[model samples]
Target: MIRARQLKDWLPITKKEIEMRGWNEVDVIIVSGDAYVDHPSYGTAVIGRIIESEGFKVAIIPQPNWKDDLRDFKKFGRPKYFFGVTAGCMDSMVNHYTANKRLRSNDSYTPGGEAGFRPDYATVVYTKILKELYPDVPVLIGGIEASLRRVTHYDYWQDKLLPTILEDAPADLLVYGMGEQPLRDILKAVKSGVPLSEIREVRQVAYMAPHVPESPDWNTVELASHEDCLNDKLKYAANFKIVEVESNKWQANRIIQKVGQRTLVINPPYKIMTEEEMDASFDLPYTRMPHPKYSKRGPIPSYEMIKFSINMHRGCFGGCSFCTISAHQGKFIASRSEQSILKEVDELVAHPEFKGYISDLGGPSANMYRMKGKDESICNRCQAPSCIHPVICSNLDTSHKPLTEIYRKVDAHPGVKKAFVGSGIRYDLLVDDFNKNNQDGNHDEYMEQLVTRHVSGRLKVAPEHTSDATLRVMRKPSFKYFHKFKEKYDKIQEKHSLKQPLIPYFISSHPGCEEADMAHLAAETKDMGFRLEQVQDFTPTPMTVAEVIYYTGVHPYTLQPVKTAKSPEEKQVQNRYFFWYKPEVRNWIRNRLTKLGEKDLANKLVGNTYSHSGNTPKQHKKNKSKRR
Candidate 1:
């Protein structure tokens, strides 16, 4: 443990000073400047836990009701060690999703559009506060927000992932990749009298300034001289191929360098931590919650929300072209035992506000549980996250038994009125079951049991798009199949005398999606009647093929070119499904429907006046004219 008086001033302290604090002593205090909490965006929480596991006392401070004053952060007690800081999840929302994704939460809350989007997020104010206070606190910034926007990229708001975040957060060390392993290595090295500058050579830690003086031509990059810097602005900033140094470090790139003194992007080819490591990390005491501060809130984790999330499994075998779950989670599954889930459930139920309902129970695909590789050895390393919305990889066990049984046990509890499966279940997996096609099919029998007996009324399913071409791109089940399942579900509900619906979600502007594709989806929804929640203008997330396509307009997998949706008018048209009923929107929809031969939809919209419009451009213009 490194002990010091100030930020970046943790010089070689006496062994007595280090020993003065027991193994449980906190040499540093970590401040997590996060915007919100959810599973997957748990970068800060994991870091805090790992540091604690290493015998360092760590406190995580929540900035939800956060004041923009740095003085507010002084409550966690002064650190005799170091402070870690981040730009929070909104930075990720800006970097990974379209800038509009940040607008999503605000949109969700605000009924008239503003109500339901990112709220309480004052990045500018928060960052300015950080800048003013603790100017010398050796701050560290990381997470998707910082990683993706560490340098300039295509930021939608500013129209690019400009150097804005770095400029604002002002981190001393910009740790990227999976930060846990890198952080420990960094802290240890610094404790060993290594300067932060010397620690820059470590893999996964992206530091400022170039390591090498010049760029090595890719073809000429030698293995021993593996560290080459890039000079080109875009490529330089993106030199993150520092793979884990495995038995075979040369697994992916033979040479990872280009022009410009960019930096040696470490894509460590090392095999990720084994299954035991993964299990140990995830299987930690579920009872442990990183106390944001040693204090009490009025009430915690509302019935509608959960404080921390426990991942049910690792890896998604489903290889959807546009998804990165496979890239991040891997292409295999390592599910936790039913017993573990029960333990988590017990903890949740024990929460003083236990209302017998968990906000959600899920993994990559809520349905995939206990999937493993053929060999136990490979399974440990095969922590791949399967894509749930589209294709279910052949390797993945699409068995619903384990999950259904687990759900039944969870739902059967007297206190729990509802157990929602928030993660989208794979629709294709359902088709494989007998119930997908036959109302009297065995699969249908299971469906009846699950839906009537186990499932909450609104079971969420992601049929990303309706058009076959679009489905093909999403690698998802087609419109024909989704409808078949819905029909079966409807019949099963009728038979069971239950009221439940397979509420399907759709995404617009996924890589291959187009105006015509969206038109097809609109038609499908019209026929289905007041059904289908749509995700408009899919923004590419980090390491996702879909995002690559969204950026390059070229299919990452097939190298094929696709027609992209860029026009504001096009986005607004498709968005009408989410915000349907704008008269101008209605006119646009009617015109679109008329063009697509969806005459009934066109007629219905223009005739009945669905009346969901808020303030349309036409309305705004008209109001302006009246004022004039």
Candidate 2:
């Protein structure tokens, strides 16, 4: 049977079980979900790769068809340890994430429905199947998806931060933070015959049944801590979210989750990769072949049509409130040499289907390449996760020389018509690239080319929100600066005769956003004629700044977020900001506007609403606000 036959994609060991525990030919199987849509890259792929590198036998089950019977995995036999690593989903959970946000939920299935065949369920399903196949194997679960789901997180669809996935999904142990070093330690400990009970004390790992309690035995806070009694406890509870773990500047290791609460609070383990380790990890002999695993499947657009992924660096320096890149990838931006990028582009140009378009090249922020703290040793001593910025750390490097050269070389390549940057460009950094006046001539020139020539239709940017008050809460772009950027882009488009438009990406229903806040945004949109087609509602993925806002109604770090109505009705109002006409919203907007004493603006809003024609959801949300 196909199930019984040897597996091709994942690095599975023998398909037959070994006789005894020690005699078991294998010690563990690291189960990882591929962030590499095409496989052989990203998330678990890297974790598994690193494991195999350590001389341990690790079989990476790339992307399993979650709908299939969990029993099929029994064919691969069992390992002394089973490690579950996911990029973002287990069973159908990954597929459920809406790529195209337009589709609304029908009655058949709900977006926040926790009990179905999700990753956690699939973890259990597979665990049980493994048990039936080989009784004593241990399954360890961890990854961002599981890490966040470790405890209750804010569920946008349900309008609350819910509880840990562990209670529901039967995982034996959980690796809470970045699992690299932690998993390595786990494999070593397990293969050496460490008992499960004894393994509980390891930092960064939260097991289901602990051999010993972390706190004093008498410190038990009841099975259903104050959380279970809340009217919406199941909806807004946190399982394992870690805030700042220590007073130390070892940022990654310091910012952590509260133990066993089902939150994703811990950061990746290391603060810096030794020069040699960084060189070895990135400078591997990577050939530009279709990732070996996916090549076996026929070519597809996401794989073949794209050129080099061109990772210029590894970490991020920005702590944009809405993003996890810096927290997850860490803030240390390790860049590749200029020669490396030039070679990759040459290869891209040589590809048979090479159009003049060189595709995209980016990493973290794409700008902070080979940057270090001003005083590396001292900066390491200062434990704040992000540099307070503008004050200057001794270790941080704000210079863009290395990055600029790479950009120049790629653009100069023979077959390259344009080199796009899919990675985000930190505009705030750009604002500072010049001589303290928010204008840098050379920075402007290169950035203009990158945005206008490269971004195919529009340069996408996330300003998150436009209110000065909200920006502070979000720890990001100032409304004043973003407005200036809109003006700058307009002038640039006119000056360069570029066809690209500014694709400003916005989010609706973030923790601090209110109906009035959205209304204010709509008014700004009307004034700017900014017809935004893309709107993202917040998804409080476990262990994020956003989740903390939903839970305590306070920033877990700072204890402040403007109270906004988080109800569905309030969200619907915000969703309509881009639209100009909808009768229900129109009426509500007019009434609300009149009460706010903006009679003249209300009339103008009505006029604008009437001028727009369509009655789609977007349209209604708009007109309703204008009229109100």
lDDT of 2 by residue, 156-214 (tens): 43445455555555556777545565666776776687854357545555544432244
Our model 2 lands, by Cα RMSD against the true structure, at 7.7
**Sequence-dependent TM-score of model 2:** 0.74
TM-score for each predicted model, relative to the true structure: 0.70, 0.74
Clashes of 1: 54
Candidate models: Cα lDDT each: 0.51, 0.53
Clashes of 2: 52
Q: Give candidate 2's error at residue 400 in angstroms.
A: 2.4
Q: TM-score for candidate 1, please give it.
A: 0.70
Best candidate (score: lDDT): 2
